[model samples]
Target: MSADVVAGWGGGEAATASGKKTLWWRDAPSARLAALGVVAFLAYLGGTWAFPLLRYYRTPLLDLGKLLDHGVRGGLLYTAAAVVCLACYGLALRIASRSGARLGVILVFALLFSATLFFSYPWGAADLFDYAVIGKVLGQYELNPYVVTGVELAGEPWVDYAPWSDTTSAYGPLWTALAGAVSRLAGKGLLANLLAFKGVALAFHWLDILLIALCLRETRPDRVAAGVLFYAWNPLVLVETLANGHNDNIMLAGMLLAVWLALRGRMLAAMLPLAGAVLTKFWGGLLFPLIIAAGLREQPRSLWRRLAYLAVAALLFGGALALGWAPFWAEGQGAWAGFRLQLFTTSWPLVARLALERWLEPARAMALAQGLALGATAAYALARAVRVRRAELTEASYGLIFFYLAFGCAWFQPWYLIWLVGLAAASWDRERLGRAALFSALGLLSYLLYHFVWFGWGLDHFSIDGFRALAMAATVLPPGALWLARGCMANR
Candidate 1:
């Protein structure tokens, strides 16, 4: 594609009235869009800096809770700020999609966004605190975090802040060991440890950006800037990975690297990073079958050759897992305990359980709902896996993850959407990208239902059922309506 076409100028050339062709950067509309994106970044930065004032839990470092009086006013202010940030993110994404967007501009803005959030308090979730406590358990006390719960280390700083204090480490051994190393480097300071973990996440977040760009360049070269911007500027990704300090970015980086290598025809070399991703978080394992399918496409039509390929792939994958687990294997035999704790109902599953409770016992209702979700997810995965081609692997992975998050996941979190957004951006599927963007905005918005509506509005009669109903509507309605409208337009 020519520069003008790539820049979204539909004609042969973008020329001035003086009959001189204008450069893309010098075009009036491009400059305006760039300026608007800059303004959005600045606005988002200010909002992140202000997050400390809305902190839910008191900390010795700073206490700005009184600024909003820690009541309904505070909640409403938080809701407003979140809404503005998401709106700004959406606008910036629109600007990035224009093909006129420069990679340099996107990279600079992404770096600034990550840096600002790196210093902000994790107001959205307490997962960072849990990570710090687990790190302390393993690093400071020299205990196996996978075997010992944070609750056992009662007096440790930040232990009280962890929501899952009674559970063992839910993350994979590789993440646990990395967290321990970060904790050891940071020493005994609470703030230091927290920032250290965020710093690691920041590094991985950038790695993910690089990997996303490289993958797009390999598969969808024309969309590199737009695709990178899609994942980099996503509000949910920023808040969850950078500010909240979730390790999902690390997992994503490994997955992206695997995809990049596989796209370049190094299918065997991709298995190591794919294994690393799974060892970072179990969800990364979902892509294994997809990768295998892609690998099979590259193999010659011979039973012995395909068998040899499968054996080598499995050996690489299993060997990586074994090496990652070897250090903690002896004492961390109960690591699966943390994974089991993550199986509680939320989102769509919660809605299902609530609806079924009218006719059956509560436990039975939940069991039935979970079973149905599993069955549906398994069927979808099988169908997609069977038809996946090497070129369509990323899109297939995105579709499976999107479907699971929508209808199967028993415990859904907003950060989980990062998985879908990352793959969708790589695939560069317009409809999937649109849906991912919509879901991201809505997922962030759903926070208000918990932080404000349920608590701030003084709705004493509000129940989990009410929250589930509103969350489901907020998540499902907008995208469903958009999909229907697009179908009607196509038919017309």
Candidate 2:
């Protein structure tokens, strides 16, 4: 694709005639469209506030409970909320594309949306409860979270809400340590602890936004708003980061900082945050080889500079990894034991096992599938980085990161898409952005399984079997259709 299409500017007329495009907030029609997006965002918040669906079964918020008491109507409100988020996301993209929106205005609106959603009740995912329970295990009981399962904390009051009774911590040491620190600060109060964790997630959320903005402004100054809003105003990013409080954003903050530093020509300094990202979540570690390739992609004619860059990157990243792993090392196991455990045990291997069950044992099938996917994605990424010039290095990295998350990872979660949000911002590819929006809209259906099948919080069990199929279709079909259509278009 040409730069125009990749930068999401082909359909919209270029504004070079005026020396530079007018910022969208300064334009009347685009500003009005942004106002409408704000209204749509408010509608989303209203739906969330009115019908909080994921309230803990043990400690129900009465107002939210009363709202959910309406059965199917409450479920409909949750769906409506997802739709509103989708609408706002689409509108923001249009405003940015057509009116040349300013990054500052888009950021202010994003921060506003994030703050509003942050305070709203945690509505759909139950991951936050697990985060709290694990943090409590570490902070209050002083146990090694890596070794102690929530089952060991069976007697603890907070464990009542944590679902992973027999499951060890699946996150990285840095994440666990940070969660423990937050747990200590919040003490034993459940609400206070939840808020504290959310605050940390929110801070990283903003940090991810800032890094994305900086990276794009440095690389593609003209497409700043498109890239920034692609990430900052992404509905999936907002919902997952602010409301769900997933640690994926924390991982991305480190990854983005590393990539942003690299963009600024500070290749050595980039390795520190890259290592931090690895410690935050091992997924970030996968980018190390790619970053090395990009660093070498620069100074292609100068072998010594390339070798020096690689050595420094290796030292900085490796040292940081060793330091971050010190806690796990002290416990007599590799810090990455959690990743190994999750690989063998979790539903992350479901797709692989399901596809190859007849040909191989479940374990073998899963291992083979994951290995192939990850290896192929990594090899492709390395080749791209080796070929691309220094200027295109970041986008190449972002594209590979998006591919790795979409296909390389064992399990797919809605929040996992947040990893792509920053990359999408950097690339500003219309097709990529469209598919992301589609995925965000469809991924919301996962909540239906929560509401209807798992808990039946708002709906009766009248057509429970049918509801499961409906939920599956809602969650999976849009992306499949999108891929199919795109393939056909490419062929034609």
Which is the leading candidate under TM-score?
1
Number of clashing residue pairs in every model?
0, 1
User: How would you encode candidate 2's per-residue C-alpha lDDT over 96-162 as one tens digit per residue?
Assistant: 7765654445666777878877765655566777888788878887887877877786567766666
Tell me the lDDT of candidate 1: 0.76
**Prediction RMSDs, each to the true structure:** 4.2, 5.6
Question: lDDT per prediction?
Answer: 0.76, 0.68
lDDT of 1 at 378: 82
TM-score of 1: 0.88
